[model samples]
Target chain A: MLDQQKVFYGILGLAVLATLGWGMSTAGPAGLAFAGAASFTIGGALMCLWERSIVRSAFSLMATFCGVGVLFILLGADFVGMAQILIYVGGILALLLFGVMLSPPDMTERKLVRVGGGLLTMGLGVAWVAGKVAATVKWAALPIDQLPEPKSHAEEIGVAFIHPEQYVVPFELAAVLLTVALVAAVYIARRKMSDFVPEVASQQENA
Target chain B: MLSNITTTAATTAAAAAPSENVVFHLLAEYVPEGVPGWILPIVTASISVGIVIALISVMAMGFTWLERKVSGHIQCRYGPMYAGGWHGWAQPIADGVKLLMKEDLIPIGADKALFMMAPAIVLGAIFGAFVAMPLAPDFYFADVNLGIFFILGMSSLTTIGVVMAGWSSNSKWSLYGAMREAAQVVAYEIPLGISLLVPLIVAGTFNLREASELQGDFYGMGWFVFKNPFMLPASILFFIAALAETKRAPFDLPEAESELVAGFLTEYSGIRWSFFFMEEYAAMYLMCLVASVFFFGGFESPFTYMAREQFGPNAFITNVVAASTLIVKSIAGIVLMMWVRWTLPRVRIDQVMTIGYKYLTPLALICVLGAACWEAIF
Candidate 1:
C-alpha cells in the first residue's frame, strides 16, 4: 500500500530514468549532460518526500548537492565545481549546522515543519530555473572528445583576480571590503570586552 | 618575449595531457592493435581505481606505523618491536586484524544511524583526495582541471563528518568538542586559503602541472621557498595555518586529550577511533603535499633538469625521486607538528581566537601585500 504522493514520484522516476538511459545510449559521454540534470531533479524529489526526518533529509540534500558538483565537473567548469563543493558543502552547510545547534532544541521539529512549505516552494522555483537553464543553454562549441583535467582552482581564481582585463578592480575592491569587514567585526566584538578590563591602582590614582 | 615563448612551449606537453585522459591513453596504448576502443578506457579506469585504492590503503597503514615509531622515539622507547620481526614493521597490519575482530559497541544514548554514517563520511572525504595527487609525471587517478581546489573542497568536507560524530554521540564532552573543533577549523581556513594564494599569484596559473613545470628550470636556488623573499614568510604562514587546519600542535584545541579526552572522538572506540586517526594523518600528509608543491619544487630535482634537457618518459623515475624529496620535506613538517604536540602548552580557547584573528590574519595580509610588491619590483 503506497501513498498517492509516492506513486506519483515513482512514476516520475521511471520517466526520468527512461529519458536518462536514452540520452546515455545516444550521447555516449556527452549525454552526461541530461544524466546530471536528472540527478538534481530526482534528488530534489526525494528531499520533498522526506518529511518525516530532518536529519535524513539534510544528508540526502548533501548527496544531491554533491551530485550537482559532479555535474559541474562533467561540464568542464572545474573551478565552478570546486567552488560549489567548497562554498555550499563547507561554508553554507556548516553555517546551517551551526544554526541547528544554536536553535532552541524543543522547537527543532516544529520549526522544520513550519518552514517546509516555504522551502519547498523556493526549491521548486530554483529547480524550474535549473531546468530552464539546462534546456536552453548551448555548449556546441565546447570540446566533446576530451575532458579537462583538474588544476588548482584557488590559484586560477586568485590569478584571475590579479588580471587587469578580467577582475583587477573588483579584486582590489574586495580586498578593501574584506579589510573593512575585519576591522568592523574586530571593533564590534572588542567593544563589549572593555568592561572586563581591570583598572590598575596606579592608573586609577593618575586618572 | 623569448622567455615567455619558451615558458609557454615548456608547459604545452605537460599541461595538455590531463591525468584522467592520460590514464585512458595509456590503457589504449597497451591494448593489442585490433582491440575494441571502449574496452581500453574501461580497463584503464578499473586499473586506475585499483591502484588508487591500494595506494591509499598502503599509505594509511604505513602512516600508522610511522606515527608509532615517531611517537615512540619522542618518548624515549622503541615501539612495536614484537609484532612481526624487524622494528615492528607489520604492527599496523596486526592492529588492523585485532580491531576487525573486536566487538563493535554502540552507546545507549547515541543516535545509531548518524553514529555509523559519520565515520564513513570522514573516511570517504579523506580517501577522495588520492584521485587528484600526481604520483609521478602522468600518474594520477583523475586530474580534474581544478585538482588542488578539489582537494581543499574535499578536505573541508571532513569537518561535517567530524561535527556529525561529535553531535550524534549525545554526550556533553562530545558536543563541546564538536563546537570547539568546528570553530577552530573555520577560523584557520581563512589564513590557509590566503597563504596558498601567495604561490598561485607568482605562478600565474592554477594548474599544478604548470606550476611544477615552471619550476623545472632553476638557475639559482630554484624552489619557490626561495623564489622570492616574500615566499619564505608566506610558506611559514602556510605551514602554521596547515597545523591549525589539521588540528595539530598548540592549534589542536579540539583533541586536547587532557581537556576533552580525545575531544569529539571521546566516545569512539576500536577501529572507529583509528578511522579518526587515519583521517587526521592523511590530512597532515595532504597539507604537507600542498606545502611542498607551493613552496618546494614538485617532482623537479635541483639540477637534474639542467643536466638533461631531452628527458622523456624515463624522466618519470627522476620525477618520482624528486617527489620523494617533497615527501621527506612534508614528513619533516609532520615531525615538527609532532614535536609541537609533545612540547608546547595548549592555549586557552579565547587566546586561540586572539592569535588567529589578531595576529595570523594581519600578518598573512601583510605578507600577501609584500609578496605582491616584491613581484612588481623584482
Candidate 2:
C-alpha cells in the first residue's frame, strides 16, 4: 500500500514537470506560472479522487477550485477569477465540507457496479474535454485594441447581468431557485422538537 | 470609423492609467542602472511580502497588549501593570518568548500532519488577503482590480483552516467549534458582502485605493457615509458581520471559553495556538481597514489634507501622513471592536443564527436597495 501511494505521488510530480516544460516552451517566463497552476489543478483533482478521508477529499476539491481561479486570473479575466473563488471556494465548498463533516464517518464501502459506472463516466468526460481542446485553436488570443479599457470589469458585468436583452431572466431565475432551495433546506434541517420534547418530559418525570 | 476610434481611445486610456504598481517604479528609480528589468518585479514582490508580514506581526503584538489593558479596565482591574513597567508595555514580548519556549505537542489521537498544517493555512490566507490592502494611496502589495472581492475570498479561506484544525484535533470540543464556525460563516457571510454593496455602488469602483481617492474631495472629508444615508446602516451591518466573521465576543461561539473550554484551541498550544490568535488579530484589522476604506475616509484626514496642500500631492510627506491616518483609523476601529468584546456578553448559539440570518441579512438587503435607489435619484 505504501509503495502504491509513493508511485501515485511520483506520477503526479512527473506530470507537473512535464506541464512546466510545455508551458515554458509556449509562453516563456509567464508559462512557468501557468504550468504550475495547471499541474496544481490536475493534482488536486487526482488527490480528491484518491484520498480515503472524506474531509480531506472535500478540501482537495477546494484546491482544484482555487487552482481554476488562478488560471482565470492568468487569462486576464479578473472579475471571473475573483468571483470564482468568492462563490465556489468561499461559499459552495464550505457547504460541501459541512455536508461531508455532518455525515456518517464509516462510509468506506466499495461496490463493483458503482466503480464500473464511475470509471465509464470519467473516461467519457476526459475524452470529451480532450476532443474540445483539440477542436479549439487560439480561442484566447483577442486583439489588444479591441478589448475594453476598464481596469475593473465588475460594474460592466453587473450591468450585463441585469440587462433586458442579456442575462436578467436567468439571473432572477437563479435567485428564485436558490430561495426555494434555502426554504427546503430550512424545512429539512430544522430541529424536530415535537419528538424530542415529549421524550425529555417523560424522562424528567421518571427522574 | 468606430473601430479606429476605439483603438486610439483604448491606447490613450491605458497609457493614462497609473503604472501597474508604484513599488515597481520606486524599485526602478533606486536600483542600479545595470540591473535587469525582470528582476525588479521579483524584488518588489519580496519587499511587499516582508513589509506586510512585519506589519501583521507588530500589529498582533501591539493589539495583544492593548486587548489585555482594555479588558482589564472594562472589568475594573489593573491588568498586568508590572512587566516592563508602564502598564505592562512589554507584556506581549514576554508572552511571545514564553510561548516560543513551550513544548510543541500533538495529541496522540490528533491527525499529526493536519494538526501542523492548519495554523499555517489560516495565517497564509490572511497574508494573501493583505496583498490587496492599501496602506496609502501609492503603497500596496497588489493593485487588484477587484480588491475587495479578492480580500473577501481570501479571508474566507481561513474558515477552511479553522475547520481543518478543529476536525484534525479529534476532540469533541474541537468538532463542536468547527460546527459552530460552519454555521456562523454560512449565516453571516451573505450579510457581510451585501452590506458592502452600499459603498461599492457609491464609489463606483472595487479598488480600495481608487475608492479612497474618490472620497478625497472637500479637504479629505467626503466619506461615503456623508454621501449616502444608507451607508451608515450598511457600515453598522458591516461592523456586526466583521465582529462575527472575526469571531469576536457575542458571536464567538466557535471558541467560547466558558462553554467549550477553548473550542478549536483545545488541542493547540504553544506557538501553534499563537498562530491562530495572530490570524484572528490580523483578520480583525483587515476587516476594519476595509470598513474605513469603504465607509469612512481612508488615508484621508485633516493632517493628510494639510500635508498634501503644503507639499503638493506628489510629496513623500503626504504619503506618510496618509499612511499614518489609515493606521490610526484602523486602530480606532480595532479598539471599538475590543470595547464591544469587553462590554457585551456572548449570545446563545440559536440567538446568533437568528440575529445573523433573520435580522442582519434583511437589514443588509434593505440598505442595498435604499442605496441603489438613492444613487439613482439625487
Candidate 3:
C-alpha cells in the first residue's frame, strides 16, 4: 500500500509538471503560474478518489481552493483571490478540519462509498447544463506572444458596489441576505433556553 | 498623429532611462538583447524566487540565534558560548548541521502524504506573502495594488498547514494544537484585518509602497503610528493581534510547550521540523515588515529632507538606505516580539479567545470608525 501510494503521488507530480510546461509554452509566465496552480487543484481532487480518510479529503479540498485563489490572481482579480484565501482556506477549511478532528474515530475508517444511481444521474444532468453554458461562452485563446501584465481591479470592484448606477442595490441586498443568514445560523447553533430550564428544574427536584 | 509622435517620444525616453529599479536593471543586463519578451519576466521571477529563498534562510538563521541569545540574557545567563568562535554567533549553523544529520522520523500510523506536505505548505505560504512585501521603493517582486490584502490572505494559508500537520500526525496533542491554531488564527484575523483597514482607509490605497510613501515626511512623526489618536490605538491593537496571528507567546496556546509538547510540531523532526521553524521566523519578520510599512514609515528615513533630496543623482544609494531602514525597523519589531515572548506568561486558550473576541475585535472596529472620521475631518 505504501509503495503504491508513493507511485501514485509520483505520477501526480509528473502530470502536474507536464501541464505546467505546456502552460508555460502556450501562455508564458502568467500561464505557467496559472497552470501550476491548476495542476495542484486537479491533483488534489484526484487524490480524493483514492483517499478514504475525511481529513485527507479536507486537505485536498483546501489545496483545490488555494489553486483557485492563485488562478484568480493570475486573472488579475486580486480582491477575489484574497477573499478566496481568507474565506475558503482560513475560515471554511479550518471549520471543516475542526469537524473532522472532533468527530468519531470510526469516521476516518470508512471507505469512499459509491453514490447511488439517482444522485449520479442528477450530477450528470447538472454537468450537462454546465456544459451547455460553457459552450455558449466564448473563451479567448490568445497566442503566447507576451507575458500578461498584472493589473489591479480592486478599486473598480469597490466602486461598482457603491457607484449608484451599477450594482449598489444588488450589493446592499447581498449584504442584508448574508446578515440574515448569519443570524439564522447563530439562532440554530445556540442551545435552547427550554433545555436549560429543564436541567435547572431537574437539579432542583433532585436536591 | 500628434499623440502618436508623443507616444513614440515617451517610449524613446523610457528606453534611454532603462529603469532605475535594481531588479529591472539587473535582469536587463543579464538577458542579452533581442531575447524573447517572455524570457525577461521568467528570468526575473526565477531571480526573485532565489532571492526570497536566500533571504528566508539567512533571516531564519539569524532569528534563531537572536531568539536564543535574547532568552539567555533575559534569564541572566550566557547562551551557547562555545558553539562558534564568539558567543556562539554560529550557533544556528551548528544547529542546522545537527538537524540535518539527525534521524528523519515519521511517527507510526501517521498520514505520510499530508505529513510530508505540511511543512512545504507552511513555507510556501510564507514565501508567497513575501512576494508582495516591499523592502524599498523599487525592491518588491510584485507591487500589486492589493499588496497588503494579498499578504494577509497568504498569511492565513499557514493555518491550513498547521492543521494538516496536526491532523496527519494522528496524535491527540497534535490535534489539540491544530484546533487551537485554527481557532486562534481565525479569531485574531478579524482584529488583524480591522486594524489593517485603519491604515488602508487613511492611505486610501492597499499598496504597501504607496502607503509608506504617503508618510514619507515630517521625519518619524509622519508615521501612521503617530498619524492621529485613533491610529495609536489601532497600532496597539494591530501589534497585539499580530502577536496572536504569528502564534507568539502570551498568545502561543497553539504550541503551549508545557501542555501540548510542541503542539502540531510534536510528530515532526529533522528537516521537517526546521521548515516549520523557518516558516515561523520568516512569518514573524513578514508581519513586522508589514507593520512597519503600515504603522511606521516603512522604508522612509527619519531624515525626511535627506531622503527626498537624495533621489536626484544618488538614487541607488537612496534605495540601499531605504532598504536598510526597513530592515532595521523590521528587526526592531522582531526584537520587541522576542521581548514580549520572554516577558509574558502564556495565556490559556479560553483567555486567548476572550482577548481576540471581547477586546481586540471591538476595539479594532472602533479604531476603524474613528480613523475614517479622522481622515474625513483632516
Q: Which candidate leads the pack in DockQ?
A: 3
Tens-digit lDDT track of model 2 for A128-173: 9989987885656733222233365677889999999999999999
The native-contact fractions of the candidates, in order shown, are: 0.33, 0.39, 0.51
TM-score to true structure, per model: 0.80, 0.89, 0.88
**Cα lDDT of model 3 by residue, B10-51, tens digit:** 111112222234566677877777887756654555566567
- Put down candidate 3 lDDT per residue, A1-207, tens digits, no spaces: 456567778888789789989988876655666676777677767776556566787778876777777666556565786788778887888888887876544334333244355447768987999999789866566544333355667789999999999999999999999989989998999988876797788998999
| Cα distance off (Å), candidate 3, residue B316 | 1.4
Off by over 4 Å in 3: A1-34, A104-149, A195-207, B1-21, B310-314
Candidate order by decreasing lDDT: 2, 3, 1
Q: What docking class should model 1 receive?
A: acceptable
- Residue B312 C-alpha lDDT in model 1: 51
Residue-wise C-alpha lDDT for candidate 1, range B245-361, written one tens digit per residue: 888878888778888888888888888877888888888888887787778876566544643354653466555655565567677777777777767888888988887777777
For model 1, residues A65-126, the per-residue Cα lDDT tens digits are 56566656555555676687777777766656655643333313335465678668878998
Task: Name the TM-score of candidate 1.
Answer: 0.80
| Runs in model 2 lying further than 4 Å from the true structure | A1-3, A104-128, A135-151, A187-207, B1-22, B30-37
Model 2 steric clash total: 0
Which has the better DockQ: candidate 1, or candidate 2?
A: 2
Q: What TM-score against the true chain A does chain A of each candidate get?
A: 0.56, 0.75, 0.75
- How would the candidate models be sorted by TM-score, starting from the highest? 2, 3, 1
**Chain B TM per candidate, please?**
0.87, 0.93, 0.92
User: How displaced is residue B356 in candidate 3, in Å?
Assistant: 0.7
